[model samples]
Target: MYRCDCKSNVLSVLLYVSECWKFTANIEKRLEVFQTKCLRRIMRIFWPNMISNEELRRRAGVSTISEIIATRRWQWLGHVCRMPIDSIPRVALRWTPQGKRNRGRPKETWRRTVDRDLKTRGLTLQTAPTIAADRAKWRSLAVASSTRRRRED
Candidate 1:
């Protein structure tokens, strides 16, 4: 019951609008810390009785924050891809801003993050839409891309 409440209420609130997030390394670290803290609290774990994050997550049946965000982003991507070419979301997905900015390094954008995630699944922006056109295929791909097969260390 506690786990369910944590997932349904806490995680959902924490991850709101996460599908559009840039998901940088710092952000990922912060999210991991926050999740572990929450889990430790809910599980009534205190100092001198530490549990590894993997063990805690396994016990609680909670997926990693990155995995959850990836799943949500891909699901949303599929929805956008399935829209008509002229649809607002489709247009927005393909839109590029004009004018150069002063920059040392380019900040990560949501699109670039999605592209990176797509490459991990051996998919590309060009092919994703066609695959997403088939709902079953897209659903399977989204879930598969986010879920890592558990391995004992």
Candidate 2:
């Protein structure tokens, strides 16, 4: 019997998801369709025994890729929040450069996604860092946020 570490599995899944996102970035399609396609491909790689979508869903019993990404974004947020103010991640989170409006609409950023996730959990930018300082508490919040998002979908 072979056992895979949960952290390694998650990291692998995240890497796969980012790759999928890169491929699908320019293609305009409904979110459901995009997610379904990505999920199918990811499931194929991760769980070969679960040949059907229904079986994959049943056997995996895990959050969707989007939810996992959201969870990870929050986890990163927590880590960045605990870092020094001058740190790169923290600076990136706080800084906005002077730029021309070269687009009709701005693309969604990781920070924006984190903000949305925080809002859904009744948290705010100012308070998130403090809340996330507690490791166990932050993990619970991230997991809960992912599960809640999954249920809504």
| Backbone clashes, each candidate | 0, 0
lDDT of 1 by residue, 19-134 (tens): 98988999989998999989888988877897799988888889888888888998899999999999998888888888875688667889899889889778888898899999
What are the models' TM-scores?
0.91, 0.65
Q: Write the per-residue lDDT of candidate 2 for residues 25-133, one digit (tens) a residue.
A: 3332344345444555555444444365445444445444455555656666788889988998788877776986577756665566667777988998889888878
Q: Where does model 2 exceed 4 Å of error?
A: 1-55, 60-62
TM-score, prediction 1 = 0.91
lDDT of 2: 0.61
Note the Cα lDDT for every prediction shown. Answer: 0.86, 0.61
